[model samples]
Target chain A: MSEVATPTQHAALAARVSDACRSAGMVGAPYPGAVAALDTLGYPTTRQERWRYTRVTRLLDVSPTAAAPHTAPPAVVSGLDALRFTFVAGQFVGGDTLDEGANGCFVGPVSVALARYPERLEAWSHSDFATKEWFAALQAAAPQDGVCILVPAGHKLERPVLAHHHMPAGVHVAQPRHLIHIGDNASAEAVLWSDTTAQSEGMMNAAITAAIGDGAHLSLEVVQDEPGTVHHMGHHHFTQGSNSKLTVRTATACAHWLRNDLHILQDGTHADSTFHGCYLPNGQQFVDHHTRIDHAHPDGQSDELYKGLAADKSTAVFNGKIMVHKDAQRIEAYQRNSNLLLGEQAAMYAKPELEIYADDVRCSHGCTTGQFDKEALFYLRSRGMTETAANNLLVQAFLAEVLDGFRPEIRDYVHSVYARRLGWS
Target chain B: MLKIDNLHARIGDTEILKGLSLELGAGEVHAIMGPNGSGKSTLASILAGRDDYEVTEGSITFDGVDLLELDATERAVAGIFLAFQYPVEIPGVSNINFLRTALNSIREQREEAPLSGKDFLAKVKACAQLVELDGKLRDRSVNEGFSGGEKKRNEVFQMAMLEPKLAVLDETDSGLDIDALRIVAHGVNSMRGADRSFLVITHYQRLLDHIVPDFVHVLAGGRIVHSGGKELALELEEKGYDWIVDAQPTEQA
Candidate 1:
């Protein structure tokens, strides 16, 4: 059994994390609630309901000696025609920086955007999760350089932005905070991809904060393909405006121990949101996805779907909460989660929480956990496919609904990652 | 092409096939008419290498090789096919893709090159036409939401594509209508050749009228008790199975 951390140990670890974040440099001044939130939330404990399945104590051992030298890794999805920005250890390394003076679009790092036009980012750069969640507070208090995408009103960014963050070999903490703001009637697309080297070991506490203005559109795809022994905590928060459309697709193709907290608040009427995610964890790895969407206004719509598989004693957890406010009538919300347990010892936890205060709302949720259909396996085998090929085909079929929502390039890349990790390629 | 001698098998503690024996030569069609629970489907499953049943005692030889040694995939690679009574509905996997994978897998195991796309599609077109299967069914998920007759036609279509040396039709005409039954029987008859053999397991004589067998055997109490030519089906259909079943030797049990 692993030893548990006491209150004093937790305090000491918090102090050490603070020192590490300070050494990694801060992004401008700390946000309004960062200091107070750090003192109040402190460190997350498994005793808390939200942290029950995740053991944050395992991350207390991360102690940094010194930051690794910055070097840009090979670009991912190179053939795709997109503006790419690379960051290593929470610092910008190389990429095309499209910075049109102040009022125009700015596609670069958050630190640069803060230094150049802090007023434009000051309103939406900080998320409410910073005050309510411990990890989010830690990230906001000492945030580092990450992707910053801003599109002015009535303008659409022609090319998608690919923000790639790499964690080099180290025993340090990297808190990279990404921010995006779309003006009224503007639109843009972006991809947040983070990967780590095999030898790297540390903590990646990242946050993505975005705000869509009225009549604006934004679509983002997030990919987490970390292979090293890194513990990742992601706090993603988005707010949609009236008549705005937001679509987010996340593919956790590979991870050791990762938890993603995603929240989207529909702050205006007729705002539409579609979010889908997929994950496959094998061996002794662990993955968790917690998502919530608030239908605060009438005529809003949201659709959520997540599917995954746990193999070889791995554990996966999914929690989705849909909240409808009192006056948010005529809203339709749907949530579904499906999981496959490939190994006898593998575990899966799924919960769907719906709090509908409105009388005229259409809300439904379904969660199912089952193993592969033995009859299907037999049918495939009787047709001459080996066990491996048959299993690969079934897994692909199971995840197609969620994975197909992503762009073709990203979909294939994520599929290859899963196939390689499971040794099905 | 296939031979079974005193094959005893069971599921869990209950014995299903007790000392069952049969033999089939190349270029011949043998129909095994049996009453309910006579282990006809059990024989088909064991021959296809389904692991649900255990062969307690006996030996099965396919083309001079120990058939029991091969797994389900290996059995298919060795030229054996079982048209299921209830074809599985596999969503998200198109029939074309499933057939391509199966065909390539068999070829790979047999040390042969995979069929080219042109040749494979041509074969699919010909085989589908043989069963009157349209392009829509060929491209849809494997038997997903298919009608009863469509599912049976799909089974025959798969048999035509695989072209197995020993084809076992386990109640292929169970849910099929007369026209569908005729189409399926025609698909099966067109594939018969000098190098191929078939084991047709059925209950009624209507299917036999469409695809006449060279010989007929009555399976009762998990063993073959009576044997005759195609005319036996007519006699049995007119007389019913009780005449042959009640006449079996009680000492055999």
Candidate 2:
């Protein structure tokens, strides 16, 4: 791979990428910096260390294009008693009224903020913390509308901020970017969901970045339950400050092909991060997850657990890596990937890697791939449960270990989604 | 009432129960004592409709219905129960949930409405006392992390709840101490009625000392070669199964 490109080709690519940025109304002219970097490094392929197990080029081969802004499609929305922000094709749609307690909170489209507060947009537009993911670069070039959440210092939001991204049919590509900045000692939770009823094959490039200040706590839940005709690519990056806690939980289902990249940077001492992910793929669907946790400072801890259940000719890939730098002594990091294969033709691949430069660090990584236990199935069947009931019960039990860790409302939502996926309801 | 006429069963190609026949009245308890590989447990499994056992010949009727035609659950609903020697442990499903599902399934088969949660809980608590199982154990997963005695007691508790017409104890005494055996026997005995029957299968006669079957049959080479009163169990325990097989007279050619 060479970091060189002709001037003509660079100019053409830069123009197309910049047009997307202008259409989305992103503030600041930081397009050239990202273009130069992409021309140098190019899009990451399967040959890269971090992308060895996940082949993202298959989905990214489609040229970057701007997704047209459209009205939010009607959906069977439940659990809407909390705060809600509806984003249509990366543009913020109208939202319901908020409570008096959320007066200082900032909600709605990112472009609104870019036009309203140019200085804040300039400062937070291009974060240096994002991974060099190709889709992330694409999102940065043509940033669409997304939610911008800001909780002031020492304030606690009683309700979660729910960001809903909707893409209509014929919109082949969407790049939605969300920026969340939490002040010191503030605590909040956010649930991000991407759903589309598009009959055509569309693509979504989503990027979310969160910064946790000192002694703040934030829980991020990302859910992707798009139709099978769509392709989804999501990137999540976060920085945990000193004494702050950040937890990211993701549940993805029903996509022709989907890729998710999560990066957590622990830059402050005594900060903690936890990443949990679950995916269920079926009907020729392919889902891949790649996660990285960087312990940049000493006395930081990170835990990662990603599990998958595949059936009906589906394939899933999980690659989780934890890096403990030389200065990250006394770091406690653990990573695990477990998969359950139901059908004979279904496949799952898992690779958990740990790189520790400090001798006193406690880091462990493990991976497992197998099918349901025959003995357990037989036991349940013998107890008067039908074969279908027995299998569903076991699968529910296996998935509950992960779902139980979520909030009650979110947990129930995930449970209903899983039940529908498993055809148990 | 039950009847097995010239029943033949095999696992793969090798036949285990060859021409085994037995009969039980409604209120009687029959003990089938055999050595290892003598097909005592096979009979219990075959009667309970375990899928692995293939029936090669003959037929069995339970209360005038074809027993062999029913699946495991159907047979269970038809009032046939098997107390597994080594009960399976389901980790996440609570014991109460498992029992209620099983009980309701059987009730549904009989065209009866399922019990309400409060009514079911009361019945379960009563049965739990009969089986001497703790209230805490009932809340845990089905047999998960339970002691050997606790698992057997849970099995008896399930039996008491289902209230089957014919109960098969398949080596239920294999791993029990004297106290567990007594509690398990009491659980079984409390379920006895004029309309219910029992088939006690054991390698040793220790369980028979408590269950006290009306008939004791010596099972040798897959067939019940000798049948006698309750004393037959004591005789076999003292003389061993080899003597029973040796005592069979060879046919004159």
Candidate 3:
């Protein structure tokens, strides 16, 4: 795909893109709507509220580069026991088998779905809400070989599905898309790990859309621990159906600059959602998390808590907004953001907003930014723990409240990754 | 087991304990009763190796080792324990875990094997009963949201577990009621033996009544100017530090 363009340049780029799609024989009968949506909303700039804290222009100012074709796949340790799908850059590499004991569980790359269900592809090829996001736009315009996870109705998978995205070092831009659809009354747990060891500086723009049917339960954990020289932008959309529950735990560490935008829609009555995150940014890294919980129906509940530990001249930002519509009465929503600064040069900005139009709703938000407790540190040190050991224990304890909520396997992986990022064993 | 000779300490440039001297033998319990600004806590802190208090001119020897040369934890491992007047609250670390780590650290310093989990739990349970601390409190974060009496009891509980040779009880009885004080005193009394000593620093003589000191000294103007048998505690309670201060200059002259 060509580089993103300004408004004046957008029209020509869209025309060229449409003609290219037609010439490549990739356009189907339903491609008009998706293409129109992509054309109208090119990319978001600093003007957009959700993209305010993150500077998209700085990331896209450089020339675009694609990932190398044949890099070695990421090394996966055994005993994961979950259905595994590996994606390199934006292309699917391969996968292992799903255990027969997993009870009708299926796992495969997005190419498998593209070959089988051509129509569902046309409907989801573009995102209407995130079309303006520059990375989202680029991801939409680019071709990707991502992952598609489907759980049949009323099927309960014994093991979680593990998807790993490994980006090799280089100044390449990757756009990977993931679509997860859980049928009615189905239950599953999924863990997505994004990692990089490449010495090259690059950016990764990833998008994930999940739809949970009525009475389904989905547990999702996303860990972002890419190289310190890389920039990452991720967008996630979750739609919860009636009487369903969606639990999401996200942890981001060691990115030069990372922006995660999470949007959750409660479409069914009595639906529930939980969003938990922990981010530790050190050195000159910057991490920003923007989350939105939209209570579109009555009798729904949502809770969000995100904690950050920043050190060594790093900066972090957290913006959480919970919206309860007028008709969405009996909605209980709470949001909290807490941060600890390890170094004097480190800083954090947190803003928790509640926009509720319903009279009978219970909504509250709290934000705190401060340093680690000196008394606690002294207490630990006085008990014979070294200063470094005390600080590590305190940081781990602070993050354990969030990490302990993750599935056991993912929790261990996240713990190892965070330990490596913090340079602690 | 512990000796303080002409101990003069200062916080910043202002001297707190000026020329204070005392000696404690093994199995002896000494109570130092004084007024609020008499620097009783300063003596305790100085012995515990608290960094804020600088020993301007003093000599402290514990078990024949120079106490001033050791850091806090080193002092702790050398059998010096100070039940802090105001114990710090450490959040997120359970009390049992903190105690275990502290105990193991000291043991490691001595090149002793660490206590096994089963043995540690039994010891903790036995010590909890001795200090009247509920077993449930062991699972909670260290001293977080603990009541004042509970904090005092927990201090004694730690003292029992560590079994320091020279235990300095710095105002451990200040914030406790009669019942709590009895439990704490009982815990302390149980640990008394020929191989250990106690330095009970307090403002009131009421705590001395329960702990029963071998000797009671009157601390006036940062120095222990009066030393007598346990009767001196009753005398100070009756006469107060004013008479002692008033009579000091004349006695010196």
Candidate 4:
């Protein structure tokens, strides 16, 4: 009856996970300090403020009894004109693996990239989450295959890359680590999508790490559309150099229970970062998005927006923090989180934390949670729209600001997923 | 085409419409003018099946069908349209897209086919022209950042698109300039036909001057205090409602 996992239990879980990864052919040294961090942080519990709304006690039971098959699922956004790669259960299945040697760009599986050019990826492969968060440490300790994109200095990728990881049907576990390093003045676009079948049931603990060099620009779109009973934990981290720009957009189209911890650090002057995310959890599902951004240098700007809705007894949480370092002057940071409760029993928790030490900085944040506008509903109804149609329109309107930021293909796919789940399609 | 007999309704414990009765035949435009707090807007809300008010004693029959039984959406599908006094501003829903959905929804409910994209666009163009609602406003979010006159004109444009049988103008002329008022009345006059009826609820007689209703009824104390021809609007406009409201019976009071 003790849901709180002890230190011994956490050690046993880690040992079992490493063995499972080794058998699954993930043979590489763990990220530095990951094993020790796992031991120190231990498994997260509701007692911790960071894990207050996200209950990881159920995740303790996620020890996969057997490995899931590595068969490839169907392609997503197939019509999208991009270099596509497919992975199943954190193993590369098929796609165009672009390996352009050490000095050139390389877009392929992380395992392949590690074996091909270890020194090239040595500096940026590790993320802060590996030494800070327990789940992230666990993922790094027993990492699996995910897409790895490395662009050399002053180079722009001609085509975007779509890395798709699918979780097949079984009680399995997959900890995939996607890495991206955009060199100075280099630019690239990529989409990291993970999906599962309705019959699929397991855990997908994933991590995404990116390093944007000076004057580099990297745009990323992340879509998590798992419709099964899987519990997903995502650790997404990004670091930007001087004059670099980073744009990250995430759409949680559907999830059973998901928690996304996104952190970004502007390590140099004049770094610009914009991150926007949206989630709609219905039918007793739960979703949490915890985001933090640090403006460590002067003249840096960051804009963060997270909007979502909880419907039909579902619960959603959003906590955003903005940290401006002591010498990070002339920084402009704005964060806003808005949520809608579509059901009487639905719940939404939103909080914004800002810590500033610089005297000449502008930082502001606002969080709001409310129900559907009755006046808007009545207006639509009076215009001849059915209740369902009106509600669908309202939901679409509420999410358009966030969802519209995604690529058209991804935007339509995510919106359709929401419609199908909500019975609007 | 419409009949309200002894309609007694209230929001919470304060009764707004007490013993209100009225009748309107097909093809007739009836204008109801009264002083402030005379249930002019309340009666319009009740006819459109707003859930904010509870009708304790009433019978609203529209074309021999019980209007009270339908929800607001069903009422719209049943050919009832209410031009809100204050139109709700819905962000992110384009005006054209909203009209299309509404038109298609009403058609689907009436067992008709959906409109084709080409035909729908054509309809939008024609309807948007009726109220002088610009092409830019037609593409923007519904009522978002629209001027007061533009919002009122948009309502008439939607009315033109829906082509409802019973149109209730609930203080539609409250916040409109002279030009916008003429445009709104013109749109309403153009839509009038043998199969369509209108219940124009207003506080000013200026709107009636343009639309020229067939009958003018003064609503006071939630009841029909006076009924006359179109000239009654002129009399009330010149003399004000103090003469009519003061003459109401004391039984309800």
For each of the candidates, the C-alpha root-mean-square deviation to the true structure, in angstroms, is 1.7, 3.8, 4.6, 1.8
What does DockQ give for each predicted structure? Answer: 0.83, 0.45, 0.36, 0.90
Give the CAPRI class of candidate 2.
Answer: acceptable
How does each model score on lDDT? 0.91, 0.78, 0.78, 0.91
Clashing pairs in 3: A44-A132, A169-A198, A170-A200
Interface RMSD of 3: 2.4
Q: Write the per-residue lDDT of candidate 1 for residues A229-339, one digit (tens) a residue.
A: 889999999999999999999999999999999999999999999999999999999999999999999999999999999999999999999999999999999999999
**How well is each residue in B94-209 modelled by candidate 2, as lDDT tens digits?**
88877877777678768899999999999998999997899999999888899999999998998888888899989999889999999999988878889999999999988989
Q: Mind giving the per-residue lDDT tens digits that candidate 3 earns over B1-253?
A: 7889998889998889889899999999999888888898888878877788888887999889998998777887788888888888876678998888788878887889999999999999999999889878889888889999999999999988888888999999888999999999999999999998999999888898889999988887889988999988899889888887888764252
In candidate 2, what are the lDDT values of residues A140-250, reduced to their tens digit? 766777887777678787788888888666535667888887878998888888887736455777888888888999998888877746678888888888989999999
**lDDT score at residue A148, model 3, on the 0-100 scale:** 71
Q: List the residue pairs that clash in candidate 4.
A: none
Model 3 earns a TM-score of 0.88
**What is candidate 3's CA lDDT for residue A327?**
88
Backbone clashes (count) for model 3: 3
Return the lDDT, model 3, position A34: 42
Stretches of model 3 off by over 4 angstroms after superposition: A1-49, A61-66, A69-79, A97-105, A119-129, A198-200, A412-425, B1-15, B53-69, B109-111, B249-253
Docking class of 1: high
Predicted candidate 3 versus true structure: per-residue lDDT over A95-165, tens digit per residue:
86442223444556666766655554444344444454545655565545566776768988777888888
Model 1: what is its DockQ?
0.83
Model 2 chain A lowest lDDT segment of ten: A1-10
